[model samples]
Target chain A: MKNYSNLNLMNFLTPGPSQLYFTVEDHIKKALKENICAISHRSKAFQQIVVHTISQIRQLMNIPEDYYIVFTASATEIWERIIQNLSIENSYHLVNGSFSKKFYDFSVSLKRKASKYEVALGQGFELADLPIPEQVELLCLTQNETSSGVSMPLSDIYELRKKFPNAIIAVDMVSSAPYPDLDFSQIDTAFFSVQKCFGLPAGLGVWIFNERCVEKSLALEKAGISTGTYHSISSLIKNIKNNETPETPNMLGIYLLGKVCEDMNRRTIQAIRTEISYKAGLMYYALRESKNFEIFVKEEKFRSKTVIVADVLQTPASTLINHLKEHQITVGSGYGAGKDKQIRIANFPTHSKETFELLADLLIKA
Target chain B: MKNYSNLNLMNFLTPGPSQLYFTVEDHIKKALKENICAISHRSKAFQQIVVHTISQIRQLMNIPEDYYIVFTASATEIWERIIQNLSIENSYHLVNGSFSKKFYDFSVSLKRKASKYEVALGQGFELADLPIPEQVELLCLTQNETSSGVSMPLSDIYELRKKFPNAIIAVDMVSSAPYPDLDFSQIDTAFFSVQKCFGLPAGLGVWIFNERCVEKSLALEKAGISTGTYHSISSLIKNIKNNETPETPNMLGIYLLGKVCEDMNRRTIQAIRTEISYKAGLMYYALRESKNFEIFVKEEKFRSKTVIVADVLQTPASTLINHLKEHQITVGSGYGAGKDKQIRIANFPTHSKETFELLADLLIKA
Candidate 1:
């Protein structure tokens, strides 16, 4: 086995499209050798890949039996699909970051009666303050805000589900997945891109939705609404029954995802989560001790363990980013308006404990 | 150097995703080592990749100076984007095959006043026979329909441009891009997926459009119409100005496409097209001389050089496919309703002359 730790490769700490799993290179090579990318989506061989991938994902995530896992181009596309299919006229959003805000904007752009309970940057939603109207057909929530690194607790998600029993709850777990130990039965739909916690390449988004979401899409189609063309829930469900996609998908990505998820299953999700928590704790401790940086999220409980966002206090965030880059480590700058003032670091499973220790040392010294 | 020709790899003659270029494996390895998949889409490095790839594509395809190259999830998505952005109400389609027919369906699903000049599966449209209404805002054509291996001659496209000066002409070159000698100025917009002639993996679609398409999208947005979300023409154009995508794309696929195009440019497009014509000629001749198979498209002018469809006369198409599989070669079964009655073979740039000769021997013998 090659020593991934000692390999002369630049380690990426950016949230998503982040460092790939050590096994991904081999998986990709196997895919190429097996001619996976060349197979037709309609072929039984391609269908086997899709079926195996969905099964592996279910095993890894402990996905509910009632939920269906469908593929999309990206999590961004899923936001639009959700708005088109599940939302009738009214939808409610809990916006704490850029990605969550974009989902709300999608609903509005579709000429839906969309309303949101907005919070400041680096803050998670307060369940008591959420004003989800009974008439709202869908409630959009960001389980982990990728931009600001603010994560809503599982308790908050469960609480929202109780409060809005009739409304479909859609969760955006783009930057945090296979780690958030959530009860899938509590949420009607959830989505995450494989480029994130799955430690795979970009291009494939995994959307998990229950029967309620499917029934809603059928209802909208019956009402003569254009849910979507190829990627609508009804179309996806029809294809998924045959273990295929509505269009030619990233077959290589899907194949790699299955292999990676299978690898993850072998390692066990509990063990992976434990390692993630430890790495997050070490990094957080290092940031707190550093004179130049502090944790961006004020509330300790709200801080995302997956994506760590830090506010540069005494020095520019670029200085520390450049310092890490000099060591052949790549981290992310803050998103949107916080571009210069903060830096984001991903604590995904692909990132080893040794790599985190090296980054933590540099961050503390800086 | 790896002897790709002698390798024990199964040669795929499916339309697409067909055989990958010999250089793809090494390019993918380089991308993994360089951590291309992990980089931020907004980063300067990622922007460089995007710009370089677009430049290479322009060089290879002889795209016009005024044309802008934007990326989408797939060519299927591009059909919807063209309808949403460029068409106001009335759109006309030339439906030669399944893929072309789907574009018409997308427009109709969007509630556009869509009309089509339909033809038989293995037939191409006659320019004089087309009933293009004067009020039609868009004319959708398939330069080379992948489903039935029917191609519209460049002269037809140019004539359509002259006949319908007011209508936006959007061409689907999904299975024939980078190989089709198209005059970019004659068509307002054209789109293709990289999995086909580009000899890369799926998940990235290239949409080439001129300023007229952009202006139409802007006008639609101004009129309170929803062009799209995230990947609207306006959003893609804005990102293209910065050499970035509106969302996280298939970075690995894009990187591989650039390297392949660069490889193609180094070999010279004229030389590649010459080789393609030669290989296609050899395959078609073998099919014509064979006792078991015959050319599906009756008209020589309409037959696609890239995808060759053959009618099985003496044996079921599946028997030939199974025979090829036994020899570690894979050719596609006919698409849709003609599944068992016909076979499709792709004569893409990645397919070597030696490989084609070997397949030709089998085809002639069978």
Candidate 2:
């Protein structure tokens, strides 16, 4: 591996905690000047922050009015909450990679009857033949699998919603939020951590759930099942109604997230998504033309636009990763089983067009 | 209310989320420059950060060799984790104020047989007369009740330990960590949020547990009981053994915390505690000499040195708070029922001696 003694100038291309937005430093400085981190969570000023944040997120994501936005520590916490609050006995998960598999394991850890339809790694799901159990109260779908660089298309998500109409459809948009243009009216819930697409620090998770999920949580509570404690859906709703959180939250993260969402809104989500497609195309083209690399996902439509995974053909994955690292550019090694044979590159909004062009130049030369 | 548009130059005195340490800005800037927030959680670099942070905390707090440090979203989450992992059916809580009461409620929410010994808002526990149920597996104690500005003395903690030898003693030091100077060997577990005395931004919690707590958690898991999902004690321990987290944690917070703890180590925890005492003395003297104010905790021995609460004698609490706000200094209102009747002032390490002297001068004339 290359020594990173001068890594202060490096740019990140890792998946999830990808890159910090150019605006984050200034917003964080403003947060310090305003004493945003010092004020009480119960203060009127904080309530305004929370209200404005939720409103900006709703506007940016085009979230429905019936949907409620709640905060968690991370998206992983949301997985456990879904199992605890939304399902009493059984839940079905469509797992294609590490993160989705972890969600499935969370359900099983909670002693719930968790059944999964898992495909081979680096493969996307075809919802047409998925079996829906009548006893499964919740169906989990990972819209974008970060580990394998495979994503279930938005149309597939809508199809799953139509087929499992009675089940609460929870989408893991941990790495794909604010870009997927997901319809909130169709899915019961979706969650994303801010570190990914939002280009903020890693601390806060946004959980958007409709009234049906809340009703399920309430029903579970009424039946004397333990949904959760402070972060239970009922507790979160009660606090959010008053524009408050049950505990002292990551105030700085929330402030920066709101500011970033406002920035994204000003830039227009459609424009951001368009740029993402262009950058992803640049990355995929470079990989296809490179003599030493190939795209991991077999189907073109299933390949992720955000996190791009590539298989090393003529050299170890580390050689290419270290070559980039030597230039103060950082991307992720393939996750889990693909650690040595694959490399995952992030195509986030923060990775500007110029940076992708530079990376493409490097890839093509190799 | 005073318009705080010009408040950027002021200091904060609110209990917790109260004040940012002077060093935080430069540390955060360095974090950004180093791309600390964007690194993969599974990387060797991130693992080194976690190991260094835990080491610094252990050094600063004089943590025993057998103790293990873990991270959470906030200290409030630790309350739920304690009930889930350590206790099977019964737990005992000593509730004096809102935060402690909330912990008791968390146990009840999980459908555990939770029993609490309640006291008036500002009163401390008298362990001598408290009865311990033989069936209780966990004993919940709050060292510093942030809501009421009352604290259980360190002596009381030791006394309770001797009396309930078989029970796991869980202490909530949310607002008084690294200041309480508790002997960890006597307690099974203790927790605090970094936004408090650590003087960092909110988003991360520090949970310190001994080997016995781990054993209990594993025992519960082995007995076919659901301890928790991802953040269960067993899961946390499993990950910590690898110097990693069960999920993607607040990476920036962990980095900043390690930096702050190193700074604290340089200043020495003893010196920090000494200054906290001096500032508390200054604030208490101001309240005692003033004709309109008095300390809220009736017992001097039980008064918290970190968070000082004062009853407004001839004016509403907001009057004094607004007076300070006009000068661009922020203080906390009395919590819950005391909201309008009292003022809570923080005597954290970040609040300098000169600021306290200035506020003292103003209070003496009021």
Candidate 3:
């Protein structure tokens, strides 16, 4: 087992692509020295890396043994894949923020009859208010919406399983993954990029799905539906059995992800998750109690424990962003139309409890 | 400029994802220290990195100023993108090997009317032999086929543009770029992965397309056709103009690519191309003279300058592969079904003339 919790300067609290995993730099050095990236994707050595990485991920995240893990360029790619492979006639989206809305948009873009129950930004979907859409074969959910820092509570997210029993549930954990403690049995498929909670670089999306998604994907192909090429679910499953991808994937990213996952497993994800709770609590409390900022998500349970969104008061978001920059801290400003008004702060595993305490102190007075 | 020509043992002569560029290690070290990977893709700092990287790529490759350089996960993604965006009716492919055939396959998978004039393995197409397809909107060509170590000579590749004057020419330079000295005027679009000639890691793919391809993409989008989403041609162009991608991309890959390109530019691509020619000659000469092996491609003109494939005559490919491994040298086994029958040797810019000379001497006995 490797060590963890190396303190670094310059706190990056952006939602996704926030900070490098503490051990990632060390892992990268090892990879480069061994020419790990130069190895053929088909090589036995590459296969070992793929197998070890997936195994660590599964063990760390408690992903079921039956779930198949695949790699794609980004979580954004998964949006298209889910729509193309799992859904035929219609897809339902519980949209709250931009990232969730994009999943719905992708279904529509793929020419599927995509129906979305969109709430106000920074709000979560309530099971009681959600309308059951007709003939929806895929139910899309963003467990953690990065753009608005809204989170659908796990209970609410899993409760949809009963309502949308016939549909494939695809969860987007672009901002918060491995941290969500998701019930994989309840969620048929889920996807995430490394940059968010994993604290790895962008690129290298991890797409995990059970047999149901694969059966649906195979059915789609049988019906002459284009489930995509290269990194399609079918091809990914076929290639992954040999510990390879249909295309040469993000080898270095995978290498680092494996090492990072291993390191997280060393500290234990449970420990990391517990630390995340404390850090998220401190940051959210600071923002909620601040004179200069107010919590963006009004509902207590709706706010994401990973990404905390705050409405900047009596100042542009840039002021707070710059204020933190002076302290060598970086926090993301509001996304899209709320760019000048909201400040989104990430409380990822890469963020230390001590560092979060410092950031919370800074936020309290800023 | 930083110096190069460092001596390193344990040579990797695989086609793509060969040895990392000599300077890549230093650049990666610097990137890790500077927290380059941790930077936000939307930050001005990240925008500068993207701009600088794209600018360096354009200048190093002498790509036209009008050409739009976009990044994808792999060259495989570009094939699907080209079919989805540029070809609405028919895509004519000049297929000889696995990689080129996959490009045609992607068109078929996308449900495009893909026509191909496939020559024998290790053979290049003659202009007279091609049966021109009707209503072809895209003409696809692989300048260098990594699978069979065959290259369609630039003259022959450019000749197709004159023959199919109206169709968008999308060239696959997956294993050959910057070394090709490609005439941008004759090719509407071309793509290559960094792991090949660029000698970076495997994740980042550089997709270069001229205004014509973008115009076709826009026309297709205007016609309400699904041109895909996220990294769509239209979205890529729009996002790139703002120095952003529609999604958070391979930040570390882009950073390393920029530094590596800068190193290549400092050394000058002309010098690299000259070295590639010389090293390629030495490799081909070694293979041709060897009693144990024979050149895979019979035609001299069709032989790739970057990847040299040779038939294993007496011994299994592994025997010769193991023989080289004994000397701390690694070479690629033949691709696909030919794995035991052939050995492919990479002759990228990173492969030094001195190293190739040593390998050539070793191959004389193997």
Candidate 4:
């Protein structure tokens, strides 16, 4: 009964699956014209596309040579795979929002000993005096909490990596990837869906994992523990070396992702990061000046640059959402139970600086 | 090296990821223009798209009301899931080709007691001779083997179902669905990738199963057997009931699949089926009349009405493949060891009648 028409025409500013990368439409059109969608995963032409894409992502992300970049259906799949492949006895999670909590739930569901240090919504996690369990095989951390607009700073992540040297540190960069200049030496694994910072269509998830993660997966798999098939680390690794996937993957999605990544590489990752930070600054500044609205995350350092949330006072969050929607800009209502109180806006690379200024003006009026 | 160029522009007549349904480009354009690619999976619009697509598929494929249709990343994933969710100790497979054999391999990979009734490549299974083990919890059958173009006729599938009444039956209709008049009451589970007969892009797998399969999955999950999360049969059933997926699915793929299904429904599934059978007839006739090529499948009943494979003699299969490539008609080289000896041409709904005739002429000349 939410009275909203013209939803299909609205430009999405919601956290994930927001506005597509500016070059996406053109890439898709070119793909169709080139019959890229019709190519077989086993075909030489497809293998070349795979090579080109992986190379583009590696260069753009500055990934180490030993790290393997793999494709999965979604970041959610990566959560399940990480647990299945890397952990056997126990796993730990830094749960600040729903997404991080789900990784913990996955371990529990898979009959593993799962532990977590959970924070309330709109709160941040502190590593000091945190109860991280002993012999915890995998530690899951969310770099950016899309639901609450809270992020764990890279320095804290690096510190945790130092503390848990024995544990495989996996980062969920679902909403913030290229924005985070992650040190592969500190992180064992990381994953992100294309809909987020890459601004491609949903369906593809890029899993960046180092040799350490692969070795653990292989060891577990060798011991007759089921790490699943077709997408097992060994299987994915075996196929990806030949420029193939263990299964017939999302050919069009992969092509679009590569093209978008190529476009980003040409623009230089530094330029993209600069735009994202600039846009995020504008959003936070507007929120600070709005007398009726308060920033959701209490600490300035914990506020996410990619997913920005604000708590509204006099006007309902839905009212602000609708006000923006009228201008063909659709912001997110609060996630989970706080839906009516907070508005979330994504400051993705696809979101231009000029558009952010206009959105800021509209938010101030609201 | 295969010495092929301009591959991206060639029209694919190979099996999966073949020519897209004629309306695909239009649907994609509309999707991009309407901001369909940007919508959140949680949005009501997306759920409606799911509802419409599922309904369209149900109507077009004649899926029964009691059966549930779910999405997976690929048919290979479905093969893994069918083994994971349904089977506990033992599973049976009727393997006639590489795809079918892989399903059996999955059961073995997952630490199950797996047995199979395997036939040679380009061969079909006979029920009378199958050494089906007792206490088998699940049965895997590939309705249409894309690798070898060998089809298990519906009558045989029904007979197998009758023989294995206690076991859950799973059919891999990866390359030939909508064209097959499947009797849902006779089978427990069936799956296909949209890239195949539905003529969408790669990445989306449509899995259809009955209440019996659901019961097994739920019982296994309840007993802490780890049927999987997010896409477990129970989770899929739960989310799909609300017209949603357990994870952020391929929204673009699902949207385009729905539009393609809608188009097929408008043309009528009956007409589509009639056209497929007719075109398949033309392909077989062309193979029979060709002096240098022979139909790979020995038995007439075993021949596929979708993927058509031919054994090239005198001239190498690669030569015929290149000849077709010259005419911009891309056919699949044989699967596995037969790659240089056989050629495969797909007969899908997306392939036009006139194009088939032209292909037939060119193939004859080759």
Candidate 5:
């Protein structure tokens, strides 16, 4: 533990828990002796904290009056639970990139009648490209593709809503929420990991569900599908309604989440988005001059302003990344198909010009 | 944060992160700077650390050289992953209590053909009462039933191993791993939450798998029943072989876990087990004299030496528990079936005689 503190070199560039706030870390240490361990998950005090935090999140998201937000392990865990609970008959998943494709595959793995309307990589799934659903039970989309560093055109979701009036639409905003233009009213269920834009640790995933989705779950329960006993939507609903979780949660992470949320509310989500845009703006401009680099996802308008995906030109990305690593700088490799051809640079809100410039200098030197 | 250190009344009695060592908490705080935020899961340094930890855990558990260990979110998450990854054809789950029942239900939910041999609450599982499978793919057992405070007789497992040589056996030792008799050779996979006996936070679950289970997973892969791609047994195998996780792990938790392992290594497992026994003995004797208190689980041999479950004889357990709360003493409630009927007194190694005396005095007055 002591040696790690003295290392002085090493950078964490992979997305999420972008960087821990010293204030929050200190707060958790102080909380260690504060009776957090002995309290039952079902206790009124702990329940009140859960309720308050959920309510605070709802306010932050500007969720619809009828919507409810619940917490889970991570966005990935919710991916599985969504299939286990909400897929009653069939699920129509829209796949534009790697992450959404994984979701579609997960649904199929669960033996659900799942179909996908996929667009080519570096392309957005236009409303025209989505197939007409025959009795669609759930509509799934990744609002922001963390893997591809792209955000779906918001208008496409609105267009889909017009076609499937009764379908329960679920969106993954793991990298989008706590950013701008994330309207919660249009979707039935939206999930995000608090670690990304929220700037907390990797443990908690926040899920916001509309009344329609809740009704569908109740209907499924009445019909005896049972969904599941643990990760079921109904069980989550009950826990949220009572302001508690069914099991003991990752309390420290949740506590830090509350702190992160409080900090965000003070700073404003728009400010964070503006900061992300600034970082991306600086990075996009710097990478353009380097003949060895090119952005992967085609349209700049649809590309994620928070995460920049760049393709390597002459040199292998590994070489450039290793050059940066020599200076104790860190960045991520492109996921899946983008692999060696691309590199991902996350411009988290807390990341500063000094850090971004440090990377730019290294890339230029390389 | 400073106020918590100054305050004399704060007592963290919750299940986990029960109370972090000051040094452990400080290391995490300092790591949040620029170092950890940039480290990659694929880095050789991180991989080596992971390998070292796994090797240490193997040595501590007395695991055979061929067996391996994998890490997960929590022991609860492993319950689902275990049945999903290992159960190929049929499984026999011995459900003696809540945690065991939940594991059985999860198997059934996964569409796995599962059989349950259950015993009444507070009574530990006996091999004689369970149906010995003619051909079992895997056997599931929870060594320590946290909710009911009963540990399935270890002798039963030894006897079953002799009678059923081919069946792979899995055990949930979340609340029992800190103490003795963790012979990994007899069991196929033994999992535990780091927060329990490990005395850390609740993010990591340590799973030790036998060579047979690994072979079976590979066979299942060849037969096309690959556990979901992201959660494949092969990914875990690759990770364990290299001493790293396939995904981004809780690095801070891993550091704390290493510290815990070092602390445990300072004293032999027998010495640590003795301390646990000493603390449990203190709590048991304190409760023995109270006319209104009786052990929740009947047999002393089957009792969890780490967690004492005591039922209120003539009064509501919650009422007495609430009385103790005023004095800043914290204790857990009976989980699942024992809810409202029993008080759980955790005999964590760090908890001393002074802590026990405070609780005993409060209970005597109440």
Candidate 6:
């Protein structure tokens, strides 16, 4: 951790698209001025970059050859898309935390005959704990919950697959995909946003779907249930194969994402994940030392290696939050009913050691 | 357009995040190296920058004092949000082109009762001919149809306000807002994506709503209709006011937008608009001179000041398109059914004079 005495004024700790990479920025500018912006999406020129980038993403994630990466908007939009395309009458949703619950709720709202398998918050899904139904066609899980700071083990998913060979498995890896340990081959599909692990910006949603999901999407499209308005998976796949998008894509964001992916490939997700673990550990150690503060999640297995959630045990959460704010150390307040009870410190890979140290020092003072 | 003879291969002409700015790229590099990616949205430091940028957007657009400028994923999301939040059972959509038709179709699919006033494909909305419905709570129009290369007149919108005082006027200025001469005072609300006129990357949506729309959003929230899952206006407003977002905000995109806005303000929109007009004129003249080309939009008033659409009257559109492609000249193929017959050229302020001439020269080669 760097000394708190001299730090840049801009660093704050929220999550997703909350950080910017300078090289990615420069790449965007160079592309713009070079007249790259004037090229048509349908032309061979644009398609190659898009196609190449997808290959890079797949290889980086160690995705199986059978899977294809499809880009969407936020992972939230994917909820509807998933329901529209993949969810048949009976699907099982494994709900462990806030985001997972939201996804389950959406499936219910869509009136899909879905069942929820609820686990304690922060106690992520375990293969043995899953309720395998006779008629279940698909299983949904969140690899990590951004709000609850939970990361489920991949083994849990593989175990489910082992027991239910016919059931299609889908994972929300918005927060988890950025970490190096995420292997896309274990599940039928994994989706995430660039804001979290990718550390670029928001607006674009990224997904990797195995051949099974693609087939499922085609089946849904053929059945007349449209899972897309502008963000259709089938249409996206067709365009992506050609290094293009069906509609006007967020060009700058995608271009920046390409640069981010290139950089990530160079640094490797392993090195980045190591750095993230170190930062989260520093914050964890700092919280553990304080009698007034306690970590929000109870289980070590479920704790997020990226986003750290801590609750103020002695002082009123708001008071401790206010104290930190006075020192210009910004952190996330609790969401929903947990307000004023917990604080979230996001350890994005883009953050420097000095920034983490400064934040740790501020928390100690508070 | 820079002597395609000497240029490298590859081109992209999608509407936004269309290209990167060199200066913006440099700034991104500086931002990344400082390990400054860890900035928090609610921190005073980041909040100040966001607030300032929003203020700048407001000022640049000459938005009314009562309206608020906020950001979202893309204007596409905003389209759904507007209908879900503000449509009070009935809306009158002005369908002059493809985009307007798409918006109307979306509203209809949502099971909302909406009426449409159609203009010819190349024509703009004429206030004198429009029907003012007393039951219609919102009047929707697209200032520029990127697909058809048509731009509606701002003066017509102002005139409609005088006649339809009870109805709120909402304009999709996604293509026109970034250019000059957008009179915000006459309209109640306007939405734009950062990728187009703003000259930033895609992923960020900017919408300025009047007091009436805000009240409508509040009313919907009170009524308990899920305003929208991710595209809710109420959530966006709350987040923006907090210097936060309903979901993880796209920080990198917004940061780049802020930089782009600064550069825009330096030159001013009027100056940029002038350059755009100059380029448009050159292209229009070139199309007029071409042996096989004819302007698709018949009337001068109906033509988009920003984009030009030309129909290949003699040679097949693809033949000419492929010929241009061989030279590494990238331009748009028409959307939907017009794909085989027309080409669209966009002349943003950033496109240099030499670029326009080169494109013209290439067309003249046939």
- In order, the TM-score of chain B in each prediction is 0.97, 0.97, 0.96, 0.97, 0.91, 0.91
After superposition, which runs of candidate 2 have C-alpha atoms over 4 Å from their true positions? A1-5, B1-5
lDDT of 2 at A319: 88
Structure candidate 4, residue pairs in collision:
none
Cα RMSDs of all predictions? 3.2, 1.7, 4.1, 1.9, 3.7, 5.6
Model 3, first chain, TM-score of 0.96
For candidate 3, lDDT tens digit of each residue in B283-362? 88888788888899998988889889999997588988988877777899998888999999998888888889989999
lDDT of 5 at B169: 88
Native contact fraction (fnat) of model 5:
0.17
lDDT of 6 by residue, A94-196 (tens): 8877889888876765557778988766566666556679567878888788777887776766777777777778888887676746556667877888777
In angstroms, the error of model 3 at A133 is 1.9
TM-scores of the models, in the order given: 0.97, 0.98, 0.96, 0.98, 0.88, 0.78
Model 1 per-residue lDDT tens digits across residues A82-179? 99999889889999889999999999888899999999999887777777777779999999999999998999899888887999999999999989
- Local accuracy of candidate 5 as per-residue lDDT tens digits, A178-212: 66576667778888886666656566777778777
Worst 10 residues of 5 chain A by lDDT: A1-10
For residues A232-280, write the lDDT of model 2, one tens digit per residue. 9999999999999988899888888899999999999999999999999
Q: What's the i-RMS of each model?
A: 6.7, 2.7, 8.5, 3.3, 4.6, 6.0
Put the candidates in TM-score order, highest first.
Answer: 2, 4, 1, 3, 5, 6
- What is the CAPRI rating of model 6's predicted complex? acceptable
Which regions in candidate 4 have their CA more than 4 angstroms from the true location? A1-9, B1-9
Residue-level lDDT of model 6, residues B1-366, one tens digit each, is: 133223334333334434444355565654455433455455565576677677777667677767877877778767766777787587889897788988887677455788999977777766767776766788888888988888877777788888888787889988777774767767778898766666555667888887788888778667655455555676677777776665656666666677777777888877877888887888888888878788888888878867788888855578877777676655677767788888877666555667678888887766
On DockQ, the stronger of 1 and 2 is 2
Against the true structure, candidate 3 has what lDDT?
0.86
| lDDT digits (tens) for residues A96-183 of candidate 4 | 8989989899998888999998888888877786899767799999999889999999999899888889999999999988898878
lDDT of 2 by residue, B1-366 (tens): 133345577788888887888899898888877778888788888898988899999999999978999999999999999999999888999999999999999999988899999999889877666877865799999999998899999988998888879999999999999898889999999999999888889889999999999999999988988998888988898899999998889999999999999999999999999999999998999999999888899999999999999889866888888898777678898988898999889889899999999999888887
Docking category for candidate 2?
medium
lDDT of 5 by residue, B143-200 (tens): 8887777876678788878878888889888877867586667778888877666766
- Candidate 4 docking category? medium
